[model samples]
Target chain A: MERVVTINLNGNAWQLDEAAYDALRAYLGAAEAGLKDNPDRAEILSDLEQAIADKCSVVLGPRKSVVSAGEMQAILKEMGPVTDSEGFAEGAAPKPPVDVEKRLYRLRQGAWFAGVCSGIGAFFKIDPTIVRVIFVIAALITQGAALLVYLVMMFVVPSAETSEEWAAAHGLPFNAQEIIDTAKKRFGEVAENQNRMWKSAQKPPREPKVNAFVSPVQKPAAGYGARMFAGVVASVCALAEAVIGLGVIFVVWSLFTTGAVLGVEAPDAWPLWGVIIGVVVASAFVTWPLRAARRAAFGALGYDAAGSEAAFSFFAFIFTVGGVWYAFQYWPAARDVIEPIWLWFRAIIAPGGF
Target chain B: MNPDEKFAPLRKGLLEFAILKVISGPAVYAADILARLQGTDFATQEGTLYPLLSRLRRDELVDYEWQESQAGPPRKYYRLTEMGRAHLDDLQAYWRGLNQTLDNLGTFGGA
Candidate 1:
């Protein structure tokens, strides 16, 4: 019978043979000694061990099963050696030292409570919303300690000024400064171009003798009727798209649930046409006013229409999803009647209501 | 320089070169440099390297740029000034001389 020793790590237990246990203990000792002078080494080693444990669980099964000495050696070997030569066996290579000068910066964009989410999101290549949600959960779980940490971070961590700043925060080379500087130079060029355009527009007309400007008169009322009509039309369209999108999601969800409960087979149909039309109408409703707002805010900054359109698309998707979810919760009564209509419409258009 | 003599100065030169090289590329800082060079038996403690680096900067042979390190804090990156380059050149010349002398001494001793 093989003797087993249990090692607890990150709340998970692993059973190891005596030889493997000795090896692991020896390895940990070496790692601790090697990293004694380096403050970050302990954390790095901990994370590395966790990573190995995670990989092991996937590779080797439960903690109760006897883990062979070879298996334990393999895991330690894969974790990379505590010493430099030992690292080579695990295919570890020495990383070039990081250049700190170029990467540090103050983050300016994506601030909700102090730009921590935005900075972290950028560093980890995750969406800011996900990071924000995780932060909120962490804060709640830690009984506000996480919030305190977040507040401290807000005060202590500077906003990232450039890509180099982001790179540095992630432990990348500071050489990214050259790239950021180039981008800034390009932005300056764009600004200069806009300035020249504005100057040309403001220049007095070439005609030598023009009558002194007749007193400019207020004509705000002249376009009031047209503006009012446009506003009404826009409001109506927005209302219609929002109502229809919500109605569809509500009907589909109700049908799905009822069918599942009643042991009825859900219809197999592709609702591609409805989705496409819904998306298009919904997008137009949200986009038109948003585009106008974007133009007003960014026009002077030389932003193009395409960029505004892209922003509109991204925001519209979020709005559409939110609107559908709200409809599912509040308009449950409409589902019974609307379900058949949705199905019929889907059938007529594409024969399948997905 | 004989083989044994060459190893000592060469080792010292390499250490100096490592410091200069790190500083010249981008300013990582002394602490970061020491941390990175940890596993290698190049130098034992960071305390010694820092003072020597500071002296080098003060001597005008090397200059420094203040930049932030990702690991924890702001770091000072050292760069080789014109004077430092001149010093490195002189050191290289001395290394060549020592190497040739060691080669000659080895042959003479064998004879």
Candidate 2:
């Protein structure tokens, strides 16, 4: 008896026996790993999938629907085994080759602290053990500053997601039999540990239901491009938050002590008066995006805010409504007060307009 | 050393030249290229050839397109690039020159 699972491939539904599904998943996973360095990877992978689907349709025929393990093996054979560039492999008939770009990316699959040592080892074509020793000595000489640098690099340097990247990081040709063999070995231990965690329900199982070839640890982090984009968003949000906070402080001080803001006289000077109300409204306007931006930062990490997010959503909602109401009310009063100031601003900013 | 081991790198080097030569005529998928190479001295395992194909692409010697096939998935139909054609021409000229030199060496002693 076999477990049959339904999967959607290129928008079509496929029912595959568990073992057959695992084999197919692994094959695709290997293809993905192999082509990661290719610029047109998405198109290549999709084309590969389409070809497989077309072949399976012919093999299975319209009458036969269930994809069997034997059929899967036949498909793999027909596609031809992905092996090393050189005919020989140290271990088993070489696993599929992933020709990743010759660049450094930390692999989390076998990492202890970070994949930095592994990446450095790969880039320089040295043993990772030697790199580790060098790091330790460097850290000792630098009074533990290297550890901080390591933390920065953890985010700065992208982690290896594919076998090819892993190989390239460790200074080996991406056509690596040993890396896959080690991955298979390390995967069993990881699966055992994860199985225990899965049984405990520590968090949702990270592994997809079908793929045996894709170890959870081999999952690629967001590319460096994506990380940099998120970093920029975070910095922009922080700057916006700071500017808003300062604006609020200055507005409060203006309402309490003086009749003006940025040297412009307020129409109503009291702490609870119209100008103060408008400033409060403007403060809420900034608060709305500040909370939303923090959520965007967490969204980049695949996380969501639990308790504080709900409060922020409510606060942002209220301010959005209040900000609109205050702006409408104050525009008439504010417009009159700003007429002379506008002329003064035009003289300073755009003498041409004046 | 095994004969196969001795011949592997020699075959591997020429396979790059071979792939460009075969695909230089008409665009073909990976399996098609392999099938053409079969029954030839440079026939290789699928595992071995993919990385070479990858290298060729990286070197800008080849480019591929996903052509819809009657079979399961869209096939990656590979063809030689401008650089690859120029490279293949150079390799052919080098081989012809080398073969002439080697043949002349044998004739110099025997004749």
Candidate 3:
């Protein structure tokens, strides 16, 4: 008994022999490859699917429930191969060999950290381990500048997810026959070799997960556009966080140092005490927004932001209120420090020297 | 060389013109267009027609609307645009000019 496979063509369903299903899928794939340059590829594919479905319905009868492999051959032969610009012609000459351009893309399968080094390796046909070693050496020599370059590459370079991209990444022709061969086990051997090499290199005797760093929170397969959009958003969020974090740390550090110096010189200086207290209180208020900003950044990457946001909000509200109360008690001390600064500011703005 | 291989490029070129002529009359579905061309010199597969139709639509030469079909899903009914009509007119004129040139070739039998 021959194996029958059920397939959904357009909106209609049909059962075909296993061989027939493969043939039909390959035919459609070839058509897709042929129309790769066309802007209306999706629409044309949908049209082609519907046409194939219509033809299948005509072939099906009360006696013949399943479409045979021979029938499928006839149908595909009748439909003819899709060529660029020209749709179909009877007994047309064989299609000329089209040039396939190789592209550099991060391979998601054997990625260590965002697949930057591996992608470079694949492009240049070098061992990924060698590329990783070079990157580590470069990063050390440049004082972590190369690590920053890796981060930038992760954002700029696309991850090869589709069959066409995978084929292109390996410098293989993206034809129907090639796609079928490459899509299955072409990269499997390379990925396995990389894993073995990586595991062996580790000094400690421990189980090493192939994608240990990347597997956790691995992003869902998204189109190139969606992936690029997420990368841009994440980069912006990261930049903003760095700026805010640095600014807060700077403010806290200067205030603490100034207060400590003045307080040590004059034990009775209430203004210096106020400066120290203000720094402590201000950090609490600052922490809230930083945490919230972090939560927003995490939330954009499909992570749960509620836990951190709620915890920080509770502590921030309490600290802000306590700081407000402390400010009232140290009103005189704050005024003492403000008076000289206000006078200095006014003197600098005056037309003549005071 | 095979006769089919000889005229393949010529037939492929004429297929689009035939499609434009077919759609210029009425808003025809892809299936209807295929049926009309069946057994003709320019007869083509649905695979070929769809992409060509898409290209025509992209060029603003043809536009399609989804119409409810009696069988299966909604069908795309394609009609010629104003630009397409003008393009067809030019092709027709050029074709007649070529026919005239061919017919009058015997008169200038210098070869």
Put down candidate 3 lDDT per residue, A1-354, tens digits, no spaces.
445677766656688875566556656656666776788876786777777778888999899888976688678777777665743444345454343566778875677766878888888889999999999999889766676677756655667755456656766432344435432433343235442111222122222223333322323345555555655554544444444544454454445546333354423555755765665577667655655655554344333444334423433443334433444456876555545545666888983766
lDDT of 3: 0.64
Q: Write the per-residue lDDT of candidate 1 for residues A189-214, one digit (tens) a residue.
A: 43354322112222222222111111
- Best of the two (1, 3) by TM-score: 3
Score each candidate by Cα lDDT.
Answer: 0.49, 0.60, 0.64
Measured by TM-score, how close is model 3 to the native structure? 0.43
Arranged by DockQ, best first: 3, 2, 1
Worst 10 residues of 1 chain B by lDDT: B43-52
Query: What residue runs in model 2 are displaced by over 4 Å at the alpha carbon?
Result: A9-12, A30-51, A78-354, B1-5, B45-51, B65-76, B109-111
Candidate 3: tens digits of C-alpha lDDT, residues B65-86: 9999887788889999999999
Clashes of each: 15, 20, 1
Q: For candidate 1, give the lDDT of residue B90.
A: 81
lDDT of 2 by residue, A32-110 (tens): 5555456655544454555566567766767888887668657665665444333332323444444445776765545
